[model samples]
Target: MAFGADELRVLRRALATVLHPMPLPDEDVQDCLRLAGAVDEAVGEAGRMRAFLLADLARYRGALPGSAAGYLELLQDALVGGYDPVPDDLAALRALRHRPVAAALLERCRTATERSVRSRLAGRAVPAPAPRGRLLALPGGRAADGEPERPKTPAAPPGPAVPPERPAPKPSEVFPPRRRPVPPVGRRVAG
Candidate 1:
């Protein structure tokens, strides 16, 4: 996740040009894409892919209820192009709470969402945010003090050595004492 000063400088310049209070002018969009490419390189394929998909899903989910102008058509096109709402997209739907369609879609997608994510979006407390933690942030090594934690692979804690498993007993040892087969079911023999 390390990026050089030069790399960050490039992104900063590109982002400065691309992101504006108003919508991006068409000409600067390529610069935005270039910044995104740099970010993808930093974060990696899966991270970038999920973020990209989630962003698109959020946009479409926001646009879904729109009947004004071309909004519906835009939403339809986005969906047709393989954008399905992801668990993160549920927050946007939640904002549209009064709308029945949003409610229904939330209900439908609730089952598909990872239980921890669903619980979070539903405002329910879950024990310790599952094993992976948040999708993008808080990856691991969060401190009990709630600081932003550095991610580290947990090492196995040192402990008493596992004593070697005893080898299996021989079959005769495993069976009842071999010399003591004196009695049948119907009658007892005097020992």
Candidate 2:
């Protein structure tokens, strides 16, 4: 995400050469080389992965039509098997639906509303404030007024000194024997 001095040099050179190639600067040439190297590396990687993803996409596309048809057929079969069609004129069937306490509940609810409204209007209103007398101190340890007390933070104890990290062994040093030269394939070689 961050560009260093070398990347900056490359960027300046790239802009100069591509847009205005004549009387090109050395900085521009270095920039062009850097960009070409980066592009080549990216292209090499993309070439390897592009074919793999494309093949997977082709396979999914091939199967999509058949899967869609199978789902449609399944829905059709379910509807045919489970449903028993009812007639549009169902007034006689609907008339049987009724709650036993429906009429009694309605009468009680209407009487309760009338009693609540009468009681609310008859009740007297109250004024809710005490007269100013003795001012009590706030729970924050302030004297009868609002002020924040600064809580002291404890100092951190010193940590132990960290030791320097050791360098990792090079690949050649780690596997020296494997890198040694072998005799020609035709020759009978000894280790």
Model 2: per-residue Cα lDDT at residue 177: 29
Q: How accurate locally, in lDDT, is each candidate?
A: 0.45, 0.37
Tens-place lDDT per residue, model 1, 26-113, is 3344444465566545335434544554565456555655631232233333332334445445665566557666565556545545
Q: Per-residue alpha-carbon lDDT of model 2 for 6-64, expressed as tens digits?
A: 77776655555446544443444445556656645644544444344344334533454
Quickly count the clashes in candidate 1. Answer: 0
In angstroms, the error of model 1 at 116 is 3.0
Error (Å) of candidate 2 at residue 148 is 80
TM-score of 1: 0.23
Show where candidate 2 strays beyond 4 Å.
1-9, 18-28, 58-191
Q: Against the hidden reference, what TM-scores do the models get?
A: 0.23, 0.23
